[model samples]
Target chain A: MKPLYVIKIGGNVIDNSENLYHFLKDFTALDGYKILVHGGGKIATQISEQLGIEAKLVDGRRITDIETLRVVTMVYAGLINKNIVAQLQRFGTNAIGLTGADGNFIKAVKRPVKTIDYGFVGDLNNSSVNANNISNLMEAGFTPVFCALTHDGDGQMLNTNADTIASALAVALAKHYDTTLIYCFEKKGVLKDINDEDSLIREINPLRYEELKKEHIIHSGMLPKLDNAFTAIACGVKAVVIGKSDELGKLGNNEPFGTRLSKSNIS
Target chain B: MKPLYVIKIGGNVIDNSENLYHFLKDFTALDGYKILVHGGGKIATQISEQLGIEAKLVDGRRITDIETLRVVTMVYAGLINKNIVAQLQRFGTNAIGLTGADGNFIKAVKRPVKTIDYGFVGDLNNSSVNANNISNLMEAGFTPVFCALTHDGDGQMLNTNADTIASALAVALAKHYDTTLIYCFEKKGVLKDINDEDSLIREINPLRYEELKKEHIIHSGMLPKLDNAFTAIACGVKAVVIGKSDELGKLGNNEPFGTRLSKSNIS
Candidate 1:
């Protein structure tokens, strides 16, 4: 099977121009089919503040009210997504930016009113990802840059989590391609000591992941990310990586950098 | 050849919820391949006012500074375009929203500074449209909703005019389809008298168009729109119509609803 890289970049990378420039260069240099899933950064919050809209959060998850949804859609899909596509085009990568609604690439269900009413938020799973159309686009030689937004397949647009989207895409494309899902952020990898920059845990298996969690080495913030990584691995994604943005080229080459997640030990 | 309808809706229709809802319903009902091009309505101006971004208009044309370009990209591509696509999908139209930048379907050159420096404005002609990708997308069974924004083949996104985009798409697709370009606006048709809604000019051939202009019957804002219609007709489009938004279905059936621009007199 042909290899396809599905890379997800967080706010730390996208909010900084220098980091984005470096990461995009490495991304364009990586040969073969690739997809980029991007997260909304501080810009959305800043814009909301400017517009006098309040950002609500519950247990580290955003409550996407109508106004917040509008702000994120504009920032994520419009500003950041287009800017990235154009820059990739400049680098000779024929990139097309998309929200899940464009071409119905991804259909998600609006999060139901639970304990907290998360307005216009979407929850997606493997079935929600339109892998056929996306694979067709890759076959046609257009790299897709997806923003963190999805449609209910009826008429509503919903704000979604980028980490979950990356995992969903990776799992969906795993059948057609040997998929590698990489989560690029500010950290080098899952660190043994949070305060120590050089303490990188290179490779992790399902067993090690639990051990680390029980030891309290993997804290609250990295919990969701690690869960997504493990989920992608279990769903048949060949590999998953959580690493620093600057090390993307190394990840592309299958070199040892960042924390690599596997179902078991890759022995 | 299969027929293709290329419709351009101005700000008046988009700014009003009822008008847009009505127009979308009628548009989805139209048979055959179709493309919808929409202009940024007063919403952009409204947001600009709130953001304290000064909108500069010279000779009734917007002077797109960097900030204005950002606003239009957010509103047209992000908010309006996505909303329209999702709504159309609700009506079972299988709609896919696009900016010219999306698939690189349309490439425009930034307007060169002469007497006035129209900061990030784009100028597009026939060759600027990428009809091949569009035809392939239509063949894949998706109706395209285009917003008035384009990119330089390089890295810059430019603000483009929706009317010109509709004409360019019509002219480009004319080679593949029997194209009918419709410009739907607030008025019923090109009226012989501006005040008299009943004074509709039924059919307008090139000869009559010239005569009407020479006799001072056609004046003001309609002149540029007429120019685009004539240009489309000359470039091999089968027909062109300028009429009211609610009359979209009537125009599609060749019912002689609007000021139809044709090569010769259809008597």
Candidate 2:
């Protein structure tokens, strides 16, 4: 199987133009088939506020009301996604910007009405991710840039998490290609000391992950990210790395770059 | 060669929910490869007013400054495009929403500064539209829903005229398929009397078009539209129709549904 790179970049990287361009340059320089999944940054919130829409959140997850959905769709799918695709095109890469709604690429179910309804938010199903369309596009020499939006297959576009999208896409594409999922952000990697830059963990296994959680070292935002990374590894993705966006090539080449997540301690 | 339907709907139809859905049903019922080009409606102007951005216009055409460009991109690509695609999906038609930036499908050069500058507005070039990708996608069974946003191929998304996009795409796709370009607006057809619906002209040829212009019957907005239609017909689109959108199938079958533009009056 040919190698495919499925990289996810968070809002922190996207919000900073310098970081985004630097990361895009590195991303364009990489070899092999690639797909980019991106999140809506603070800009969405800023726009929402400007539009007089109050964002509601619970347990760190946004409640995607109708107005919020429109704002995110505008910012993420419109401004951010197109800008990235255009820039990549300028860099000589034929990039296609997409939401999961495009080509029925990803069909998600609106999160069930539970204790806290996430409104228009969607939870991806097992067969939701359509890898064949993406593989065909890549074979035809186009890189797909995806925004954090999906469809319910029944005429509804839903707000989705980019990390989950990256993992789901990696799992789906793993059937056709040797897929490596990378989560890139401002951080170098999972840090041992939250404030210390030099405390970057070289690699981690299932056991170490649990230990870190038990010791409260990986708290707050990094927890869910790491959790998503390990989930990707377990889903047959060839490799998973959480790292700085600019160092993606080094991470892919197995150099000392990011915190590589492994299913077991064998590696 | 398989027949391909490249349909364009005006902002009037799109702004009305019932009309848009009715039009989509008619669109999806037609049997063949298809692409939909849409115009951003009054909602853009409404949003711009709410956002407090002054819309600059010279002789009725918008001058797309950076802020105006963002607004159009948001309204056209984000809200309107996705809604149309989602609705089509509900009707069991696999639809992919697109801006010209997606897949580098349509490349344009920024309209030059002549007497007045149309900031961020683009002029389509001969080599601008990438029809091969659209053909590949249609062959794969996805109907592309195109927004009026195009790219300069140099990291800038430019506001483009949707009617122009429709004509350009029709001309480009004419090479691979027997393309039928349909321009759907609120009117029944190009009427002999503007206020009389029964005065619909069943057919138009280059000679009659010139006569219409000479008589002052076709003036203002209809002028550019007819000019573009004639250009498309000259460029080898198998047929061109300007009509009510709900009558697409009848138009396809030549059942006197719309004003059919012909290269010569012989037919």
Can you tell me which runs of candidate 1 are displaced by over 4 Å?
A57-61, A214-219, B57-61, B252-254, B265-267
**Distance (Å) between predicted and true CA of B231, model 2?**
1.7
Output per-candidate TM-scores for chain A, rounded to 2 decimals. 0.94, 0.92
lDDT of each: 0.87, 0.86
lDDT of 1 at A165: 90
TM-score of chain A of 1: 0.94
Best by DockQ: 2
RMSD of 2: 2.2
User: Candidates' DockQ values?
Assistant: 0.60, 0.71
DockQ of predicted model 1: 0.60
Q: Cα lDDT of model 1 overall?
A: 0.87
- Provide the DockQ value for model 2: 0.71
Q: What is the docking quality class of candidate 1?
A: medium
TM-score of 2: 0.94
* Model 2 residue pairs with clashes: none
Weakest 10 consecutive residues of candidate 2 chain A by summed lDDT? A246-255
